[model samples]
Target: MIDSHCHITDKRYNADEVVSTFAEDGLEAVVTIGYDTATSIEAVRLAEKHERVFASVGIHPNEFTHEDSLDGILPLLSHPKVVAYGEIGLDYYWDEPERDVQKRKFIEQIELAISARLPIIIHSRDCDGDMLPILKSYAPRITDGLVMHCFSSSEELAKEYAKLGFYISFAGPITFKNAKKGDIIRAVPDDLILAETDCPYLTPMPHRGKLNYPAYVRYTIEKLAEERGVDFEYMERLTTVNAKKLFKKIVDFTGEKI
Candidate 1:
């Protein structure tokens, strides 16, 4: 199993301890994502020290400031442990309502991802109005790949993204009793479905209200398996395979690079 997206870089958790517990949680790789330059650097630091941890560096929509530069981020892509270019995209929920600014930064990062030949981890929210069209416009440039992190969109939108070749990642919210998107999970094809912890946030049910850790992903895996009515091992194999397919830099259990 693997956590396609997480933030072990967050001050809330001990990075070393989290990396050490990955195996016990049945996780093979954990992508410690960043939302800005500072967090991006922290993510790389974690990835550099832990073989099981990989990193994705980018500025989240809300983190985009005039001073931030894509040039600074481009260099990190060469790191062996750096797997992707994001957690970047539009977020209307925040005070950063400048759509043009968000779009420009997102496109710049998309270009960087293309140049680096790495997939992008998207962090879209409350911007469905323009998310699909913007993604559609840039679909040609996203050659490596992309994923909708902690996706909370409708099944219809999910299908649209699937058609655009974007992988759909589900997090803890899927396990919430109020979550009405089980149909969305069932709707996604096995090959494009992925799972994530999005830790220190979106912790899965039964463990909700507590700080999330990568190990808690098992509960999500269990929930997804139950939703699909498949065996736990089957769901695990499916998501792991899907994650490896997108984040090609991830290594296998034998230390063989994928």
Candidate 2:
């Protein structure tokens, strides 16, 4: 299965066996996130060496102090397996510093992603303005490849993104009993839905407190299948097809031949 959004490059999961073993199951690939200049650089490095790992290049909202942060990001886009730009977006949850900087950094990364013509994995948390406007502002440049990674918004917002032609990517949060994430799974159109682990962070239940890895996505798929009332294999196929449609390059990297 495709883990549409994850952080394999995060030091927390960089172990050789941990990284290699996680994918031996149904796990196809993990998207390595570029959280800063240094990490963005490392992400591409991992993607280049590992066939099952792809890269997303961008600075996290909390990791930037200057526009120059894009310096390292721009060069990494040409890497063969670097497929997208982000984990970059507003996050009042991560840093309460100032809204302006977060907005600026978000916009800058959007501009860069647009220029590169790559999909952008997004993360927005508790910003004051309506989420759609923030997402819409970059619509002109995103080229229809924007993924709302680990989306935790309301069903209203999920429908809004579906209307905007953006993909709504869900994660382990959806498996939580009271998360209302179940509503999102039901509300999102099957064509517009995608799945992710966002590993090292939103690990699914039974392993909630442990470090997340790609193998655990099966648990999420099981939960999604139950929520949607479809068989597990059908849901897995739908997510796999949806992911390939969005990322596109996984077909090439893994020779998936789907």
Candidate 3:
């Protein structure tokens, strides 16, 4: 299985050791996401050393600052292991500034994602109205594609994203009791589904509150398999296929070159 979104670069996770040990998690590939220039650089650097890890670079909504530059993000895409761009998007549920700043930064990041021509891993929260315009504007410009990371919406919202041909990525929240994400997952087409840890934040059930590791994603995979009522192997294959398409770096670095 693969973890399509995770902040392995976060200091709380002790990224240096975790990145080295990720392969032992039985993961074929993992995307170590970025929320700023420092973490973006860290993401790519970690991907460079580990075959099972890949990188996505972009800033977060809450991190928005007038001083933030598109150049802070653009250069990371040059790295061979950098398969995607972001962890970037609007988040109104938490600390929020004026709507204008949030909108401006989100668009700027998407524009960078377009220039880089890489998939964007979005962290949208409680600002769908504000976030929708940014996504709708550039639906056609990028080649790498897009994923709604740790999605926490409904079937209707899922269908909206599905129309854009975006993938719906599920994290530990999906496995939580009475999760509000059930309809969202149910609505996603099989091929458009992916899994994530969003590690150091939303650890999957059975290990909730523990420091998340890539290996713990196994629990999430099992939970999803049950949700879909399919065998575990089938779920694993489907997600790997999904990941390979969006994060092509994995197909190049994963496993022995048969």
Among these predicted structures, which one has the highest TM-score?
Answer: 1
lDDT of 1: 0.86
Shift of residue 40 alpha carbon in model 3, Å? 0.7
lDDT of 1 by residue, 92-174 (tens): 88766488888888888878788889999988888899888888988988878899999899999989999889999999998
Residue 95 deviation, candidate 1, in Å? Answer: 2.3
- Which of candidates 1 and 2 reaches a greater TM-score? 1
Top candidate (lDDT): 1
The worst-scoring run of ten residues by lDDT in candidate 3 lies at 249-258
lDDT-better candidate, 1 vs 2: 1
Error of 1 at 252 (Å): 7.3
Candidate 2 per-residue C-alpha lDDT over 1-258 given as tens digits, one digit per residue, 9 for 90 to 100:
877877777667654565677455866777777788887888788777777878888887877654345777778886778888897888887654477888877887788887887888888787636457878776765673888888888888888888878988888987877876677778888897888888888999879988998778888888889999999899888888888777766767776553
The C-alpha stretches of model 1 lying farther than 4 A from their native spots are 252-258
State in Å the error of residue 191, model 2. 1.4
RMSD of 1: 1.8
TM-scores for every candidate against the unseen true structure:
0.95, 0.93, 0.93
- Candidate 2 has its poorest 10 consecutive residues by lDDT at 14-23
> lDDT of model 1 at residue 144?
87
